[model samples]
Target chain A: MRTILILKRLITVFYYLIFIGLIAQLFRIINQIITGKIHDLKPKIFGEQLDYGTMSLFEIGLSGVVPVVLFYCFFQSLIYLKRSLKDLESGNYFSALVITNFKKIGILFLVCSLGEVIGKLLFFIVFKSKFHFELDSSVVLFFIMGLFFMFLSEVFQKARRLQQENELTI
Target chain B: MLAKREMKSKELAEIIGITTANLSILKSGKAKAVRFSTLEAICKALDCQPSDILEYKED
Candidate 1:
C-alpha cells in the first residue's frame, strides 16, 4: 500500500517533468529562430540527436496540428490515470471504469508510431539532416508508447467496471 | 460466461436526468464515457455501490 502511494507520486512527477521538458524543447527551437542562429536546438534523447525533416509530409502535418492533438491526448490520458490510481488506493479497483475514447487514442498512437518508423527510415535515405532534423521519429514513437500504456490501463478500467456491475446484479 | 445481470437502466435514467438510451449504453458497457455525478445518481437510485454495477474477471 505504501509502495503504491510512493509510486503514484513518482508517476505524477514524471508526468509533470516530461510535459515541462517537451514545452521547453519547443521554446528553445522558437527562441533559436528568433535569434537567427543555425545551431541545432531540437530535443535529444540518450545523447543522440533526432532528425525532423522539413520536407517530410508526415512532419508537416504533425507540426501545426499534431502537437495540439498529442498534448490533448496526453492530458486526457493523465486524467484517466489520476482516476485509476485514486480508485486503486481506495480499494475500488473493482469499480473503476475506462471510456472507449481512451482505446481510440491508443490505436491512434500505435498507427503513428509505425508511421514515425517509416518516416525515420525515409529521412535517413534522403539525407534530410547532417546532424539531426527538428522533429525526431523517436519522440513520435514515445508518444505512441505512452498511448499504449494508456490502452493497458483502459483494460484494467473495463475489468473493474465489469466487476462492479456483477456485484450489483447478483 | 455466467448468468446475465439486470439493470434498472430506464428507471434509473429517468431519475438521473439521462435518456433511456444513454443509460442503456452505460448498462451495456457501450458508453464511451460517464459523468461522475451521473454515476453517483445511479448508485443512489439503484441502492448499491458502484461495484454492484461493475464486476471484475480473471483471465
Candidate 2:
C-alpha cells in the first residue's frame, strides 16, 4: 500500500510533466511562428518535414490532428492508471473500477503506440518509399505492457468472481 | 425444524452466533456452501439431524 501511494504520487508528477511538456511545445511553435522563425521549428513537428512557408495555417493545423489524438490517448491512459493505482491503494483488489481502468489503459497504450507505426506508414506512402516495417524497441515494450494489462484485467475478473462465490458461501 | 422447536430465525441466528442476514440466506437456499460447524450448530439447536433439513437436488 505504501508503495502504491508512492507510485501514485510519482504518476501524478509525471502527469503534470507531460501536460507541461505539451504546453511548452505548443508555446515554442507559436513563438517561432510569431517571430517568423518557423524554419527554426523542429523538422518533425508533425511526424513529417513540414514546409512552413509553403503551407497554409489550415494545412499545418491538419497535420497536428494525429499528434493531438496520440496525446489524448496517452493522457487518458495515464488518468486511468492513476485511478487504478488509487483503487489499489484503497484495497480494492478485484473491484470493477480497477479492472475497467486497466482495460482502458491497455487499449489506450496500444492505440497511442500504434500511432507511431501509422505515422511511419504515412511517411512511406506519401514519399513512395520502400515498405520497411521497422519496430522500435520502446514501441514493442509499450505494446507488450498493454497486452499485460489486458491480461491482468481478465485475471482480476476471474478473481472477482471467486471472491463473490467465497463471500456467498457460509 | 425452526417451527417444531418454536424458534424464530432471529433466535436461531443468535443462538448459532451468526447474522440474521446469513440465516436468511441459509433459509432461502441462496448460500453456496455451509461450514460444518455452522451446520452442526444448526442441527444441535433444532434437535434434528442434517438429513432432516438438508436436501440434495440435481442442477
Candidate 3:
C-alpha cells in the first residue's frame, strides 16, 4: 500500500513533466517555424526523419499529425494508468470503472502502435517506395503492454464475477 | 413460500438475521447461491424442506 502511494506520486510527477515537456517542445517548434529556421529542425514521424524540402505539404501535415495523435494516445493511457492506480490504492481492484479504463488503455496503445505500422505500410504502398520493414523496439513493447493490460482487465472481470457470486451466496 | 407460510418477507428476514434486500434478492432468483446455513434458516422459518423451495429447470 505504501509502495503504491509512492508509485502514484512518482507517476503524477512524471505525467506533469511529460506534459510540460511536450508543450515546451511544441512551442519551441512553433518559435522556430516563425523565425524561418525550419531547416534546422529534424522532425521524425514513427521514428524516421523525413526530408521536408522534398516532401509535399500533405505529407508534412500527415507526418505532423501522426506524432500529435501518438502523444494523445500516450497521455490517455497515462490518465487511465493514474486512475487505475488510484483505484488500487482505494482497494478497488475489481471495479467496473477500473476494468473499463484498463481495457481502454490497452486499446489505445494497440491502436496507436498498430496504426503506426499500418500507416507506414500504406505510405510505402502509395508512394511506391522501397519497403523497409523496420520494427522499433518501443512499438513492440507498446503492443505487448497493450496485450497485458487487456489480459489484466479480463482477469479483473472474472474476479469481480466471483466476488459478486460469493457476496450473493449468503 | 412466505405467502404460503403466512409470514411477511420483513418478518422472515428479521427471523433469519438477514436484510430484507437480501431476502428480496433470494425471492427474485437473483442470488447466485444459497448457503447451507441460510437454506437451513429459510427452511426452519417456512416449515419446509430445501427441496420444497429449490427447483431445477433446464435453460
Scored by lDDT, the top model is: 3
| Reference-based lDDT, residue A78, model 1 | 62
DockQ: the better of candidates 1 and 3: 3
lDDT of 1 by residue, A1-170 (tens): 99779968977887788789879868986787688642443433224354443325455334335344545655665655655666667776544243443454565565455544444455444443443334566667767575776776677677866775654431
Q: Give the per-residue lDDT of model 3 (tens digit) for A64-135.
A: 775677778989999999988978999988999889999999999998788777777765655446685657
Winner on DockQ between 1 and 2 is 2
Pairs of colliding residues, candidate 3: none
Interface RMSD of 3: 0.7
For all candidates, state DockQ relative to the true structure: 0.04, 0.80, 0.67
Per-candidate TM-score against the hidden true structure: 0.44, 0.84, 0.78
Candidate 1 global lDDT: 0.59
Ranking according to lDDT, highest score first: 3, 2, 1
Q: Output the TM-score of candidate 1.
A: 0.44
What's the ranking of the predictions by TM-score, best on top?
2, 3, 1
Model 2 chain A poorest ten-residue lDDT run: A39-48
Candidate 2, residues A1-170, lDDT tens digits: the string is 67888899999999999989989988998899898887555456433566756666675665667778888998999989987887798898899999999899888888877886786666555443557465888678879988999999999999999998888787
Give candidate 3's error at residue B45 in angstroms.
Answer: 3.8
Which 10 consecutive positions of candidate 3 chain A have the poorest summed lDDT? Answer: A121-130
Complex DockQ, candidate 2: 0.80
